[model samples]
Target: MRYLTRGLFWIAVYLGLALFPCLALLSGNMPPGYGYWWDFSLALGYGSASMMAIMFFLTARFKRPALPFGVDVIYYFHKYIALLLFLIVAAHPAILLATEPVVREMLKPAQINRYMAAGVVSFLLLTLIVVSSLWRKQLNIPYDTWRLIHALLAIAAFILALIHIEGAGYYINTPGKRLIWPLIMVCWLLIQLYVRLIRPLRLLSTPYRVKEVIKESDEVYTLVVEPRQHEIPAYKPGQFAWLTMFYSPFSMKEHPFSFSSNPEQKGELRFTIKELGDFTKRIKEAGPGQTVYIDGPYGAFTIDRHPAERGSVFIAGGIGIAPLRSMLRALADRKDQRPHILFFADKSLEKMTFYEELKALPDQLNLQVVFLPQHPPANWPGETGYLNREILTRHLPAHLSELDYFICGPAPLMDMAEKELHAMGVPLQNLHSELFDFV
Candidate 1:
């Protein structure tokens, strides 16, 4: 019922955005239409512009608004929806140019007006934003730098698009319609201030200090930080937080990591990070007393949300076991008697993280661990090779389809596991996965 309410809320929000321009147009006198295509172009332009404005709201990380749907899903929506809306915005101009000779004439450099020029520049900036994001890894753009660029480009494009719309003066001719654009602009500005200034200020006031950094494996390390002044809120197992180390909260250089620590342990937070990205690679060098800022407890992957789940199946690869470990520890602390199954995979036994801790879990809770190594030791007796249908079917309980499957790992592994789970007749709602790679 909670999930349904959230879904419905988001649907209503989208419907409101889509119909905003139409509502404004109807509220007051509308200017003369340039036939069907031109009028259609204007409607599309307004709708797409509205979408662009709301993109900021979606990514702003407002806790209450994001509580319904995980922030991770919001980001994925922001990414794909940006692309779709960009196409719609692009079509706004394309239809005008293709159908109207006046628009084609206005496109010429010598004859272009300021309004036309603004629209052109806005389109170009939007194109750059999309291309850079889609090819950031290939283009070798640093995550921090790319994020800064993305924000700036989005702001500039939205501003220029608004200018183009106001100057074009077609649908927004009346006093009420004119007031609407500025009101929307103010709302966007407020959201930007909250995201960029206010939230960072709050984070700065409540800082955390690194108590220790423990090496979990050759490539994975556990960072332990405790609140310096204020007590942090308790996060659910399987949720993640953004860590800003050796930088100010306003620096925008944070990286997301799962809370590997038992949330039952208050005042202290733990993140098990692997040497993967540029930021994570430096985690090994981090020492005690380093001040860090955290901005989360976000994500909908927690088992606590599904209180009725009798059993859970956790599938993890490499460092993806971080969140699952938190859940297991929480269950153990509660002395949970529910059946729990874990399939933890790594390249070899030596590479598996928290080996001793995981081995001791069965004694604490009704748990079973299945360790799969890509390259097993000569005398190894457990399952070997990648996760496949045969391995899952053989080990999964007879009530496999009824169990909640929590999968986390590299993208490819998660994809394969989800496919296999579906193939084995698990319902979609029962299969949960977190895509933590948010830019």
Candidate 2:
């Protein structure tokens, strides 16, 4: 059933692309030497390219790691498709200008050329977005600021592109094509409006009141938000939620934080945040009684969905310990007897996010916590270095193939763990990781 649904979705997308160009060619009012067939082909190319862009953005936003092959392949697919779309869209204008003489003629300054001007503006904006994204670091723009600019530019591009298509008077000549594209645009706009406006407004009626804010470490703070009315849906052990500190949904400043508390507790949602950027730095100062909006329960990294016999191995680094702590607390709360090991790596013991809480979990569940500190304390007893092949092999299950590993941390740490695990004979299928960034 899932495969059928996915197949049908792709079919609809392809048909939508094909219909644009065919409708352009069928329009009877085009001038001579226009090569209606060429115009139709260019329209199909542009439409398909734009569709790929939309899909990439959606997949990236939703953090879909795997597509269908039971592998983390969709991330690479999204990246490549974005590159292809940029190249194809860049060529779209050139193809139209060269193959269709009437399009070039339409570019002249006249009252009838307004549609062409709109198209040029839209294409320019799209080009700017593509270029800026490709060279964002070189441009010296931060990710948060670039994200805001990208979103606003995309909205502008979509509006201008729609106006250009409508004013072109080709596809609009057909009632069916006119209705189809406009309806698709309206649906897209409505979805965004709901995500940005309606959903947040709905959350206002059921806010999570801050109960307590505890400083777990130098940079780490744990926030406990109590449900004011009905409790929020129970999340899986390793899942995350999008949180807005301010009540306004339109604030354009929401952060995805992993739950550091156990899922068994329904009265409160706990999040451990590290002071990293503008939004996160203020988390430590937030007091009780402040209203926060929670909009998630997303992510597929959970132990509940996997087989119990597979066991569990958690790899965490620094503040990446947030989700791992959630999983550990959950296991302890449930009194699950499954064998699990937590390999936590940090620069120092002072930077560890959940020191006392983790130490207390082993009293309730079958678990082991191995701390790897770069700099050891005066009487440090635990492992005192980074988690590499030797440390992983030493602490991991004797039968590495029987365990499922969950790794989350900085990109470099995750990469290192994955490499070490694979070298230690853990199958790729037995490993799961999540990328927390929108990139």
Candidate 3:
């Protein structure tokens, strides 16, 4: 129900943006409908520009509004909607170039005006934004640097688009039409300031000091930090937070990591980070007493919210087990008797970070741990190789569809696991997945 309400709110917001140009036209000084194609092209341009502006608000990581839909889903929406807006906005000029000879004439160097030049520059920037984002990893751009560039390009493009519209003075000729755009501009600026300035300032004041760094595996480490002045925000098991360490929150370098500690344990916060990126590679260097800023407790992939579930099946690959460990530990702390099945995948027994710790969980709670290693010793007697339909069918309880399944892993493994579970009769909604690769 909460999800439904949030969905409706976003839908209404989008509908309002789509209709804003039409509303402006109705306020007088309204040019007669220039023909269906011309009006539609202009409307598409206006709507797309509005969507581009709102993208900032969506990715700002506002906690309350993002509660219903997980931040991962929000990031996915941000990526796809950006593509859609680009297509729509491009159609505006394509139609104009094809239909109006005057537009084609203005395209030539001698006939071009400053307004048309601005529109052309804006279009090029928007194109760059879409192309760079879609191929960010392929382009070999660092995530932090890419984010800063993306934001700057988007803001500049939107501002130039508004200027082009004002100079064109076609649809936005009336007093009300002029007022509408300035109001929207004000809102956009406020959201930008809040995300880039106000929120970071708040996090700066509520600083956390690193208490310890525990090596979980050769490639994985747990960075534990405690609050210096304010108490850490209470969070549920299987959720994640953005951590900014050895840098200012405003530096735009914060990275998200899942909480690996039991949430019931207060004051100190633990993040399980793998040496996957530039920032994460230096995690081991972050010693005790280093100040860190956190902006999170986000994500809905948690077992606490669904207490009614009779049991749970957890599927994890590599460091993806971080969040699931938090859930298992919390259940053990509570002495809950609910049954759980953990299917943890790793490359080898020696490299498994929490192998012994997980083995101890069965004594604390009704839990069963299944280890799947890609390469096993000849003498090994347990399951080996990748998790497949056969392995899942043999181990999963007969009432597989009745229990909730949580999967967190690399993209390829997650894709395979989800398909296999569905084939084995698990309902779609009963299976939840945590995708950390937002880009």
Highest lDDT, which number?
1
Count: clashes, candidate 3? 0
Over 4 Å off, model 2: 1-43, 49-81, 97-112, 142-144, 169-173, 379-381
lDDT of 3 by residue, 296-373 (tens): 899989987666367999999998999999998998898888788999998997777788998788999999899998
Q: Sorted on TM-score, highest at the top, how do the candidates line up?
A: 1, 3, 2
Error of 2 at 74 (Å): 8.7
Tell me the tens digit of each residue's lDDT in model 2 across 199-249.
778767777889999988778889999888876886788888779885376
- What residue pairs are clashing in model 1? none
TM-score of 3: 0.97
What is the Å distance of residue 339 in model 2 from its true position? 1.3
lDDT value for model 3: 0.87
Estimate every model's Cα lDDT from 0 to 1: 0.89, 0.73, 0.87
Q: Which residues of candidate 1, in runs, are more than 4 Å off? A: none
Model 1 lowest lDDT segment of ten: 25-34
The TM-score between candidate 2 and the true structure equals 0.84
Candidate 1 lDDT tens digits, 1-439: 8887987888698779767976788665666677999888888898888889999999998776688778898899899999999899899999998899998898899999999899999999999999999999999999999999999999999999999988984877778888877888999999999999999998999899999999988889999999998988879999999899988999988898999988987879999999987899998888888899999899988888775367999999999999999988999998888999999888988899997889888998999999999999999999998888898988898888889988999888899999989988999988889866875
Give residue 381's lDDT in candidate 2 (0 to 100). Answer: 80
